[model samples]
Target: MGTAATDDAGSATRALIFALVALACGHMLSTLLRTIPAISLDLMAADFHIEPQALASLTSVYHFAFAAAQIPVGAAMDRFGVRPVSLALLAGTVFGAVASGFATGPESFAVGQLMLGVATSGMLMCPMTLAAKQLSAARFGLWSGAILSIGNIGMLLSSSPLAFVVDTWGWRAGFWISAAGGVVVALAVFALVPNQPAEHKDHSSPMAQMIEVLRLGLSRPLRGLIALALVSLASSLVLRGLWGGPWLMEIKGLTRVEAGNQLGAFTLAMIVGPLLIGMIDRRIGRRRQRGCREHSTDRRRHIERAGGGSLRRTDCALDDGGHGSVVAPRAGLVLSGRAFRRPSPAIAGDRCRRSDPQLHELLRFAGRRC
Candidate 1:
């Protein structure tokens, strides 16, 4: 019985890893879709004779599609399992890639990019959901981080490596390669990932559930986080996904390869940032609350006392029950250079383990400007 149990555990672990890897591939493609335009925009623009305004619209279409898909994807995931939903959507990525490879005009390219965005929407969320169902809560963060790190590898590849490909083989070839890889990733996901049953048996209409979720979001406590997330993420996407490369090449006067290398630093930070944060969060554990609070308060006080300038609207997130623990609000300052508004006293009283060590590192990295 002991031997049998060990064998079974090993099998499950392998299966879990396999599923994560397949999902990671999807995520990798997602990142590639986002980053490719950064590196290949010049080539694409030249090929299609795209004007500046059209180029901007073409790229933004992906984000538009991606954001629009979230609610419908969530509903589909609830009705179907992760496996089928993910696989089906992933095919969109493949289609988009191939279509873009052969695109003759800006309009066609935009359609392909939109399809890519829609198809790859489930990449990260579905895997995390799968982990929640299959693994322990303690392991969920680690696995999610792993999956994100793997996706960052795609971002990394889309930088200097993709630049090399575009330089040598032309940008169209790059799209074809991505399309082929997407097919392989889809097949792997289909074969290896097991179907997960719906977590909620409520059988409520998806529209109703979506409406309820939106209603819950109307709560005051969630507003600041939502606002912070939207503003910061939107700006980052505009920079990284759209204009970063042009700025580096034009303003900074860097070569294409050099620009790609610089962007690689951003991607590298993304890859390492979460892992380091997770480690810090884990180590700080319960100490996060009292220690982080004291440290932040005293540090801010000292800085101002020492003439460091008045601290901006620095906010700390106290824990809340029911929902998964959000990183302490101070982390937002560290990560995004913006402090969130503190939650209400009622919301703050609900406690969870502290996760501020990672925030400290982010603060330290970002410097006092945040």
Candidate 2:
């Protein structure tokens, strides 16, 4: 039994390592889809004689293709299995990269970017799906987060390193190098990835499934979140993918390398944002707990001394928005008051009963002060 358990653990470890390696390649390539234009925008504009608006639209076609491909790619993963779908997509991306490098005009370059976007759409999803299958549910989130963080290194590379490459060998040479790297990744994926099928097949077609998700799965709150994500992600992609380098160079009066360095700093901040937010969230939770306990204890002692009787403890809880009401008693009446916090307006008003007119007035005055 022990030997069998040990063997199983070893196998799982190996599978996890392989899955990460395969995903890393695809993720790095996907980052290139976002970063290539940032580093090479000037070269592209000059090469194709395109204006700023035209250039933005051309590069944005990548995001358009990526968004459009999601449903079909998810369906492909469900029905055809991950390995084949991923291989096909990654190969298309490689082909697109090489074609873009060799593109003679704007039309060809646009087509290449569209293909690249379509191919790279499944890069992150395929790996996540594979990880879900390979690891336990409890471990999935941890492993997936680690994989994504590692993949961000590609974004880092696309900054100063990419600038150096483009400066030394030219932008076209950079794409050619990426194509070569894609080939190497493709081989690694081919050898490492298995044809893992969905655990339960959804008989619905891709479009049908997508419609169902929109109708049933997306609640009002979820829809709001999706809209928020759309705005934020759109801004990030537009800035990092197209405008950042140019803005830095033209407006900020920085060299290409300096702009790249600034972009890298921006990417680093993005990477750290979630961690900082998480830490702050935990701290806020702890403070809220401590505040609640101390407030309850102090209020209860005051109420007991004033009323000359014991007070019953009532449960008070914050809503999702982190606002709540505290209930306590003073003399012969009950007092309900609210408190405010950051990110939302505070509550300060209080309500009391006329059972004790004088006490009610005093509590009302205290509430106003509170």
Best by TM-score: 1
lDDT of 2 by residue, 251-360 (tens): 77988899999899977865565334333443354432443454455456544433444553231221223111122212111111112112111322232232322222
In order of listing, the candidates' clash counts read 0, 1
CA lDDT, every prediction? 0.69, 0.65
lDDT of 1 by residue, 88-193 (tens): 8888888998988899998899888888878888787777667766765446557767777888788888878887888889988878988888899989998899
Q: Report lDDT (Cα) of residue 67, candidate 2.
A: 89
For model 1 the local lDDT of residue 80 reads 82
Model 2: how far is 65 from its true place, Å? 0.6
10 residues in a row with least lDDT, candidate 2: 331-340
lDDT for model 2, on a 0 to 1 scale?
0.65
